[model samples]
Target: MSEPFPTIRRPADRTQMILLFIVLTAGLAAGLAIYSSATSFITFIRTASSALFLPILLSLVLTFLLEPVVSFFERTTGKRTGSIFIVYILCAMLLYLLMQFIIPQWQSAWNSLQADLPRYIKGMTNYIRDLGLKIEAQTPFIDSADLVERGRSLGKDIVNTVIVGTPQSALRLGGLFLMVPLFTFFFLRDGSRILRSCISLAPNRTFEMVHDLSYLITKQLSHFIRGRIIEATIIGIVIFIGLSFTDIRYTGFLAVFAGVTNLIPYIGPLIGMIPGILVALVDLGIGGQFWWIVIVYFLIAQVIIDNFILIPILISRYSNLHPLWVIIAIILGGNAYGILGMVIGVPIVSTLKIIFIEIRQYRRTFSLSERLPESES
Candidate 1:
């Protein structure tokens, strides 16, 4: 008799089918929600956009950055509470010094510009007339008066707009300023607990992979943020000194703007130069000397910072990305969300690049396995 037929059960496809159903349902729900949101959104996006989020984002980034420091403190003190308390105290003191000392000096410089406006305006007018005379002497046919009048009209338009809009903008800004510190304090206090709670919910099968990615993201983000602050601070101080040496009247204000803009990566240097050049033009008028000297200073400073400072740090940390990719990311980000996007685009791109690399590696290994010859049976 033939061996008794044993029951053979086919592998259940239920698990995969359930997963596919869940994914499809989620996708459909997301699509519907997004469509509804697009159709019925009620908030003014600009008003909704707040710097209140900045401190929270900064605190989250800071928590990661200072995690090692906090951990060291914990190790020495043998208590997490002590570590957090000590770290927070130091951070608070630093912030207080920045607000009390640095900001006041910067504000003083700004006030000086406002006070010396009449002198600056007179110097500018004389310089412009001299330029007009030289141009008329060189090309005795062109309408110099029309050109000068148009320039004055444009300046008046810009000044008028600023004067009209500033108070409203300030009121909006005051609201966010009130909110940022509160958000930051909570983020700093609870960030680790929040992270751990989020991590705990990840599926067991994917936990290790997720944890590794989390660590990588933490490192990359912290490095990028900390490096940016340091670089911007250094650039701002250098610009202040360089501009003060020159005859540009708004040196301090321009330098501070440049430093703040420098946080935006590749596009930052170009953006930072605009205020400097404009102030230089306004101060010395439209003369070749003013333009040439301002351009030269900007070029020299950018060269020094780009080659000597950002190169070594960025090249090693973001060796995976190309300059072309960086530029594309900046442009896309700027178009999508303006300055904030430009500032954050490169770091976001770097994170995505890491994820893409891992995915590609996994796919390649899987493909190789499928292509290999089977053993003889």
Candidate 2:
């Protein structure tokens, strides 16, 4: 009996196969070139859109945070506009209090730090010198004086850079603060209608899938943002209360900094503690008990409280992503868009994961349906 399928044996068949291979290789090269161009174009577009639409983007984020409250108020009042106005009033009062109390305190602390910069630098130099002396005792080649000088120069450079950058940063922030509220108002008012309109654009074949996907993604994003805000607030309050017991200068500012930085997973808490440690070293000396206190407190608050308690309850349940993947996402995000990228990376990755799972399930269902007729026949 002959084999059901014969291997290629003819010269012409071999020539045809070789030609097919060459064609495929050329087509693949062309496809890769096109993909590369598309990627570059997408990057350029993203950069432009980020710059142009930052306020709108921020407003959308704010809408996500405040929408539930708005809806609750709307349910009670039976008026969306009235609910939004009420929320706006409440926000204004909160902002006023922040301006009256927190901003001044933070500004005063900042000013004090600036006024005492020279002293901090001198203290830091002395700390480095003392530490370097011990090292020098162990290693004769170590130069305490050089170490002290380098530390002093680094301290001065950091202060100078911060001083130089503040005005530009403030101006940009002021613009954002002004624009975000206006955009947020519109988004809060029309968000549902907008979402419905977008969903309506999907074809009937995929309409149900699109609708479900949209709801799932939106719910996930809203939960993530609100949970993060709550987590940051809790962390900030805890840090502030903890630091208030110690003689740390700028306790509130440091607490706020820690809370904000806590948004970036893994590395954020570490960075948040830098200013606190530097401040402690300046105020209480390098070898003081307060140094240990600050370090221990940060470790407990950030690593233990955040990683073990808050994250598990607030974020992990919703995302259900692995720690390794989270770290990888943070690294990629940090590389791509700096701090903003780091803040958003995990959520973006989680969204992608959801889409992938949904797609896989869809394909499996499709395949099973196709196989049913064949199996029956």
Candidate 3:
């Protein structure tokens, strides 16, 4: 009996290989199907989420950004709701004062811009035409009559966009902004309970993991928001100060544009810098020493401060996102939601990544973790 050889089991390993092959084949099929339907899914999601997207997103971000302030006030007043109200009142007053100063200056700059837009457009087009072999010569294939008609149509559009678009956009934004205070109020007042109620839908077995993920994401996301505000504020103030030292017209306007554009992540600097450069080119023409010096100094100083100082201090370690991913996110966000998308994309992606990592870690720690009911859990 002791000498008898034990049976070697080859079926177990073979069965596992077969099962893996089936699973991989199924996954490939599912992936292909998903790729095929991606456009429709995106359209459905975009349409469905468009209505309350900004409102909800803004509210959540404000709530997170203001959390530390709220907590500090809470420690003083010993009441969460009262602290939220206090923060809101302070915010409201600040916004009112800021808007009063900004709106009038912006209006003057806008009117001035409307008067100069056609000249800028003409100069830019001439500059474009000068760049032979660079633009692929689409203008030559097109008839002069067609070009003139298109130019007129474009000019009208430009005028309308500048004159009509700005105020209309501001009004639309104002209306959207009106919802923030109300949403922020209720959210700050009862956000924790609301979040908990949502999380309570998960099964008991996975409650800890879900809760931990939420906490990790919330903390990081809030930090990201605060860092952005601080970074934008610093850059804006610095730009304004630098531009004030220049002979450039509309320094206030240019500085404001620069700062506001900073909210759009990597693409923001180029956008913000363009108006100043254009104005300089139009004002001083090409090869003006003053224009070159001012633009170069302004851009370099801002870049040095932001990349070396503000970003390293505020975002790099805290955000824990790769530069490549940040760029990708900005592109995707811009494509999906324009400027606002670029602004919020990093935080959203960071939050999602943190959640995924936490879930993965939990599963890796326990071999049988996947045995639990995923949906119920």
Candidate 4:
């Protein structure tokens, strides 16, 4: 009867099950503790401005973006340091040229925007008053005068903020700008050494796994950053070109705003719309439903193209994340790291996924003590 079909399990099997459960439970507790501590550390590090750590972190991010160019130059020159300098110099020149050509237009648009603010507010208020008149018979709650007063107060506050905030913002940015390139140079020059040092921390059994995990994270991360940058550029250019053909005021500013905000995901596009909406309402003279229609149509069109066409073509190819997970990652990252968190959240999550996958794949390759029966161990 085939030994009674081995109907009863061995005591060894029960011991193995207990060991597995204990191991899993311990691991879960450790993981949660580690995660909490890591986030706290990250938050602390993010607040430091004078620290080399911030620059080093920024360099790592830029390295991922500029690795290809650096590699190409390295191959041609056979000198990593030389390649980095050449790339930096080239970047400086390109930036200078771009600023030379584009800054004037931006300056002009900004001035125009500033000058038009009060007039725009007045136009909007007058239009609202007209509309309120039409609706006042039916709705006694409509108050155009109150809205006008509030609008002017808001405009004045915005103007004051621009006047006071720009200097501080520029000063902070200047410090980061200097630090980023300085650190990026070192990272580009000695990145392999850095990687080697990090990999050295791994156990002998996981040396190969560590190497492969690093490669996987770097590959996916670079792809994601490159894709995001290209996507932003494309979106900006599309908006610029589309608005150029339309009658939108401050096209350059609006395009730039949209592109920059597009980095934040989900909430980004809506924030981008704020500036555009404000500008459109001002230019279109409020009760101009035709221009409102145009704005709505443009927004809908951009949404369709961004979600259906550009996203799949650009970002989805690199990170196969579901929208729900992405939204959650953004929220968690934002809560933990603020803007930087939101920006790096998806890539961070993707890298974590890769690490876990590597861990699982190599789990069996570890010592058999845990995998074997207690008697065998």
Q: Report the candidate with higher TM-score, 2 versus 4.
A: 2
For model 1, the stretches where C-alpha displacement exceeds 4 angstroms are 1-38, 41-55, 61-72, 98-105, 112-178, 284-300, 314-342, 345-347, 354-377
Candidate 1 lDDT, tens digit per residue, 271-318?
888767756776666677576546544665677675576657653454
Each model's TM-score, in the order given? 0.64, 0.74, 0.72, 0.68
> What is candidate 3's lDDT per residue for 167-266, written digit by digit as tens?
7888868977788778888888899999999889989998887887787667766777778778877887777777666666777777767777776556
Between candidates 1 and 2, name the one with more favorable lDDT: 2
- Which ten contiguous residues of candidate 1 have the minimum total lDDT? 44-53
In the range 272-344, model 2's lDDT, one tens digit per residue, is 8877787787777656557655755567687778778888888746455677888998889889777667877
Alpha carbon RMSD to native, model 1: 12.1
The alpha-carbon deviation from the true structure for residue 348 of candidate 4, after best TM-score superposition, in angstroms, is 4.4
Judged by lDDT against the true structure, how good is candidate 1?
0.67
Candidate 2 versus the native: TM-score? 0.74
- Candidate 2 off by > 4 Å: 1-47, 117-157, 286-292, 318-332, 350-377
For model 4 the TM-score comes to 0.68
Which consecutive 10 residues in model 2 have the weakest lDDT in total?
Answer: 288-297
- Which wins on lDDT, candidate 3 or candidate 4? 3
Over all chains combined, what TM-score does candidate 3 have? 0.72
Which ranking of candidates, highest lDDT first? 2, 3, 4, 1
In model 3, which regions exceed 4 Å deviation?
A: 1-48, 133-160, 286-302, 318-327, 357-377
